[model samples]
Target: MALVKVFSGSEILAQSLKVRIEAAGVNVIVKNNIQSSNMAGFGSLGQAVEVFIEDKDKEKAAQAIEDFKMGN
Candidate 1:
């Protein structure tokens, strides 16, 4: 299954979305550039973290994300 990005923001927000999406029965993977850079002993100037889900679950995940954004 192809992975599609559903959200990109702070690591905290990404993790929050991950939990919400997973609760909706969608799998999630988080990519944190800052954390990766820190592991490599390099400083990252970017603060963006990404949350990905399978393309097959895109519609459901999208609605979940939207609800989250709407504070629902």
Candidate 2:
């Protein structure tokens, strides 16, 4: 299945969103470019953490992300 990016933010926010999305029964993949950059001795310059999910779970994950943002 193809993967689709659903969210991009700080590392902490990405992890938080991952939990909420998984609770909605959608699997998550977190890509943390900030961490990679730090490991490579380059400081982050942008929103480097991203959350991704299978394209099939896009709708469900989107709702979960919205709810999380809404403080639900």
lDDT of 2 at 62: 79
Q: What TM-score fits each model? A: 0.88, 0.87
lDDT of each: 0.86, 0.89
* lDDT (Cα, tens digit) per residue for candidate 1, span 1-72: 898988888888888889999988888999899888989999887556998899989887787899889988
Candidate 1 off by > 4 Å:
none
Q: How much lDDT does candidate 2 score?
A: 0.89
RMSD of 2: 1.2
Please give the distance, in angstroms, between residue 45's alpha carbon in candidate 1 and its true position after superposition.
2.4
For 21-65, candidate 2 gives per-residue lDDT tens digits of 999999899999998998999989778999999999988787898
